[model samples]
Structures are given as C-alpha cells and as structure tokens.
Target: MRILLVLVAAAGLFGCAALPGDGPAAINITTQDVEDSAQSGDYTVVTIDPGNIDAIRSYRPMAFANQFRGVGRGGSPTLLGVGDTLTVSIWEASPDGLFSSGDSGSSQIPSVVDEHGYIFVPYAGRVRAAGLSIEGLRQSVQKKLIGKAVEPQVLISLRDKLSSTAVVVGDVAKPGVYPLPLRDTRLLDLVAQAGGAREATYETVVTLKRGNRAGTTRLEDLIDYPENNVLISPNDNILLSHRPRTFSAFGAVKANQLVPFRTKSVTMAEALATVGGLRDERADANGVFLFRYEDAELVRRLKPELAEKLAGAETVPLVYKLGLRDPKGFFMSQHFEMRDKDILYVSNHPTAELGKFLQIIAPLISNYSTVQRITD
Candidate 1:
C-alpha cells in the first residue's frame, strides 16, 4: 500500500509538469545534466518553424459552384453584326424597280450589311444596321422612304444568322464561339457543341463573362442538375479551367509528396495508396502518426477575450498507430477520416531517412546537369 501511494504521487507530479507553476525551463524536452552525460554531443534540438507548423484553429474550404447554382434561363438583348443576310419586302415597287415583293421563288439580292455597319437601299441611301435588329433596321428604312414612295410598307427577316456567336475557350476539345439559332441555347448545349471538358480534372470550374461582369461555376453542377443548364446569352465568354489541388502528407512513407486531392474527401487508405504505401522493409508498423490541430481553449473562450485572442491552447492531436503487420489492421484503415491539410506519417527505422535524402538530392543534381547542358 505504501509503494502504491508513492507511485501515485510520482504520476501526479508528472501531470503538474504541464501547468503554469512548472517554471520557464519546463519547455525543454530533457534536462541539461542528462544531456551532458549522454555524450553523443547533446541531442540536436528540433526547432519548429512557424511557417512549417500548420495550426488548424478555424479553417474553411474556399467557396465553389455557387455561381453555377444561380444561373438563370432569362435571355438578354443581342446586337446585329456584319455577314448577316436579310430578306426585305417593300410595297408599291415592281420586280425590276428599287423595291419588290415576290414568292419564295424570287431570287432577290439578300441585303448584306457592310463593314461600316450600314446597308444601301435605293431611296434610303446608306443606313446603320449595327445596333438595330432586322425589324428595327427595316422600320428606320421604311420611315426614310415615306416621302419618296407612296406610303411605303416594309418587312424584314433574317435569312442567315452567323454574325453573332459567343466564344467558349479553354479545356474543351474544340473550343470556339458557335452561332446561336432562333431560340436561346442552354449552358450544357454549348458545352456539347464544343465537345465538352475533355481535359478537365475532377470538378471542372468554368468562368462566364457577359459584358463587364464575370462569374464562376462548376461544369459538373450544371451537368448533374437540370436547373443549372440554363440559357447562355450572346457576347458571353465561357472559360474552362483546371484549378490546382494542394495537400501535404508526412511520416513513415516511402516518398512524401504534395499531390492533388482531386476530391472533397480522401480516406486514410487512399492517402497511403497515393504515396505508394509505407516502406514494408523499414517501417515501424506500431508507430504510425496522424497529426491534427486542437484548440480547446479557443473553443471555450470568454466573450471579452475572444476578440483579442489569436489562438489559445494549441495541441498536435495524434491518432492510433496500427500494427499493419497484423492482418486486422487492413480493416482498421477504413475507419480513419482525413481532414484537409492533416499530415499522416508512418514511423520507420532510422535508415529510411537515407532513401529520402537521396530522393531529394537526385532531383537537384539532375536539374544542375540540365542547366549545364543548356548553357553549354
């Protein structure tokens, strides 16, 4: 009972070491006296750079697909352009005269709007067709010919409509501005016309610019739901882009690399699969480490202190170290839920560092050789 009481007191003392009363030197992992006797020239202190240490207090993923959800089916006004053909029918004129109207068999010259955005008629001379629709341009011409002709009546309709086409660039197979027909075309139909996002990665994000205003949206969101595939207006610029994915993984892996997640959520097993799994020969199966952030004091803060506090009571919470050598561990990997920017590290034998060092140095040497060849 006396020995048990002594052990309990020692455990309580160890717990007090983290409290505020533990003095300034308590931050050191080991005592100076112990370091001096160890004789291996004192252990190298690991200085944690603030930049390298990821502190997860409050973090949210960047907004995505918001613009896609808000796309509407409304059609905006469109302007007329050159190379457009129009059929004009005028009253009180013969087939050989200045104005004439006949059946569909009549081979009349389809009035071509010139580079100056104007068309020439016998009575009206040259008039601007740039900003005016077919009916609007015809009405202006009819008003101009009223004094010259006997109460002139005019009708105009588009014969060819290839002058106005919206440009769709980037990521699509065959990207170009396609001419829109009589009815308003939806976003998905335009994508189909351009051969879709052939080179797009994961959730493809696209930008649509109409006039001076621009908005972004995901292609998948529009494709997945019928609502988002709304009508695209004329003069709208569509851009398809593959945004880079950013993530980092560390610990007892063969090669640690910052690979693209290409997804919203990634499993621990999938993360391991990305780095070619743990080094089977050198890894310590029992020392796998997953480091995540904890801000408990920040969670339970007073209202007054919350305003000024950057952060409080930060900790590197670790997860279970599975013995994958055992058969049951393969199943345990399924339960692990990986958060954004979390580092999953598996511990390994000391010699594994040599492989890591060589892997890093080889790239630098190769890059130096390439520079020499280029200079020579």
Candidate 2:
C-alpha cells in the first residue's frame, strides 16, 4: 500500500531530473542539447575513425626551432665591452720607456673600458677597446709605442666582465646571472652551471627568449638532438618550467582523477589502461568520448566546415567519440595519442541508472512490506 505509492512516485521522479546520475546520459550529451537549442552551440562532436586519427594529432612532441644553429666555431666570444676592467702590461728591452720604471722593463696599468668604448694609456691616447679583442688593443698600444719604446711587447688581461652575462630563472637549483666566457657555450653547459633543472628532462619545458625572436624546446630535445642544444647568447633568458603533462579521467572510469604522463608521450590506449580502464557494470562501451581544445589549424584540416563556422579562432572546442563495441576500435585507440589536458569520459549505461534507482527504493519497499504484515 504505502510501498506501492512510494515506488510509483520514485519511478515518476526517475524519468525527471530527480534520479541520481554521475553524469549526463550518452544520448542526451550526444544530441539532445543541440536538438532543443534556441541558438547554435560552440562545440561539435566528431567520430574517431581511421580517416580522422592522423588529422587529430596536433601534439608537439618537440617544439625546438628546427633551423636553430648555435654560435660559430673557434670560440669567438673574446671581444671586449664597456664596464670591463683590463690590465695592460707593456714590456720593453730597456728600462727607460713610457710604461717602464725603475730596474723593471715591464709595467701593468689598470684601465676600465669607458662608456665611449675607449681606454687611455700614457702613450696610447684614447684607443677603442670595447669591440676589439684584448690582443687587438695590445697591438694598438704596441703600435702607438713603436718609436717611443725599445722593442715593446704589449699584453692585456681582462679582470672584471659585465657584458657577456646570461640569466637563468625558473625551475633550476640556482637561479641567477651567469657569465658566458666562450661564444660556443652550449645549452647543456648553461643548464649544468645552474645546478641542472629541478625536474626531469621530459617533464620540463625549456624556453629561450632571445631579443625580439624567441623560441622554445623540451629539455629532452636539447639532450637528444645535438643540433637543438643551441649556443647561449648574452642577455638571453633561459627558463626551465616544471610543467608535467597530464590528462583527466572522469564519469564511468574506475578512477576519476588526473593522470600524469611519465614519459614524453602516451597513446590513448595506454592512457585508458593507466586510469584502470572503463567500469564494466556502469560504462557504455559505445560512448567513450575525448574532449579537447584543438588548434584551429588542425580543425581546418579535419572538419573544414566546422572551421568555416568558427572563423579567425585560435582554438576550437572538440568532442571526439570512440566506440569500443567494435573490434576495430581497439586498434584505433592504440594509434590515437593523448595530448596534455585531454579529458577521457565514458558515459554510464542506461540500465545503470535504473539499478541506482532500484537500490535507493529497495530499503523503503522492504520496511513497508514488513509493517503491512505486522498490521495484518
């Protein structure tokens, strides 16, 4: 009597929004919203088939600049610059010269490269030293003292350097400015100088901002590709960001959690297994969906029509459907790679909702039946 009325009311509520649901049903998500929409929606669903798998891949495995060639050979970064302290030593055969005094035939004079890129000596009046090497300035001083000194030999030593320095910030053990002595100093050398990155090579993203033209590459790419380990330039900023790639699993999956990518990349099949696969009792095999915000250029190649609808957009919202009911779907999943921030959601089976509803009312029905018997 009471149990029957409650059962009827619960059933009526189940058909409405009152029934417990982990997420929207497969059909409602797939079509119902668009069908009853007052305006067109921002997203579109596409089936994952053999024809679209290749077009779906926009993941940048290596973002390094392909044409990036490091500094030239023979170690050419010996040029002088402003704010450098130099020790100019001049040696003469006789003790009586411009840079010689007492019984010594040599003298060491300290000079700082001025703002005008010049250094002054007693004999060599205002010679350019900023753009020239130490040897170049030494020769210029020697030439100036040719007639003044007896067999003069001039030598210049750099004391304090302030021009050829680079900054290393972000996920390094040491984040500060470092001097780059040689022009051919590679990326690996710079990273080592900073006590290496705080994170693993694969998990870290290394960015190079050089003047107006900036580029980026994975730390793994620098180690693997010898050419990608570009030379460090002065005023360059190298940032090692500890950005680990990850994807999320929700709905009918065994674990609704964020899954980290251990390696450089992981296939869709591997991602599914990592999250414990789909829930057998509740999962709808036909409704395995992947949600992503794809680059507009990739969308143009796959669905030109959709791309046309969303003109001048940088990224487009996409929902990719994969049906595991077919045996072919298993092979397709193996080749479909998972991108960072991608979402894997398996819809619940329709009968699973009925199961939940029945479980909720079972205790009420049993208690009511027991009361009816006692009253009788």
Model 1's alpha-carbon lDDT is: 0.57
Q: Write the per-residue lDDT of candidate 1 for residues 1-376, one digit (tens) a residue.
A: 4664575456445544433211112122223343232223232221122221222212222222234344443343455677666776677544544454454322233587788888877778887887787778978988888877666677777765566667899888999867766567877788889998875534467788766556665676565455655567766688998664445666557678786776755666787888888777656665555545433332223112332232332331323244565655555565454654566666655444444444545665677678879999
Provide backbone clash counts, one per model: 2, 0
Q: What is the TM-score of each candidate against the true structure?
A: 0.44, 0.71
Q: How many backbone clashes does candidate 2 have?
A: 0
Q: Kindly report which residue stretches of model 1 are placed more than 4 angstroms away from their true locations once superposed.
A: 1-76, 79-109, 112-117, 122-124, 141-155, 159-165, 177-189, 200-218, 221-237, 241-248, 252-255, 258-269, 272-376
lDDT for each residue of candidate 2 in 1-376, tens digit (9 for 90 to 100)? 6668976686758644576666766786678343222126466677889888766664443235532444233122678998788898889887766667776778989999999999998866888898898788888888988888789998888886666777899999999988777446777888899999898888888888777656676788787677678777777778999988899998898999999998877988899899999999889988898889776666666766555566766566777888899988988898888877899888999878767777777887789889989999
Clashing pairs in 2: none
Evaluated with TM-score, which candidate comes out highest? 2
On lDDT, the candidate that comes out on top is 2
What lDDT would each prediction earn against the true structure? 0.57, 0.78
Model 1: colliding residue pairs: 251-345, 252-346
Q: Give the range of the ten consecutive residues with the poorest summed lDDT in model 1.
A: 21-30
lDDT of 1 at 340: 45
Error of 1 at 187 (Å): 5.0
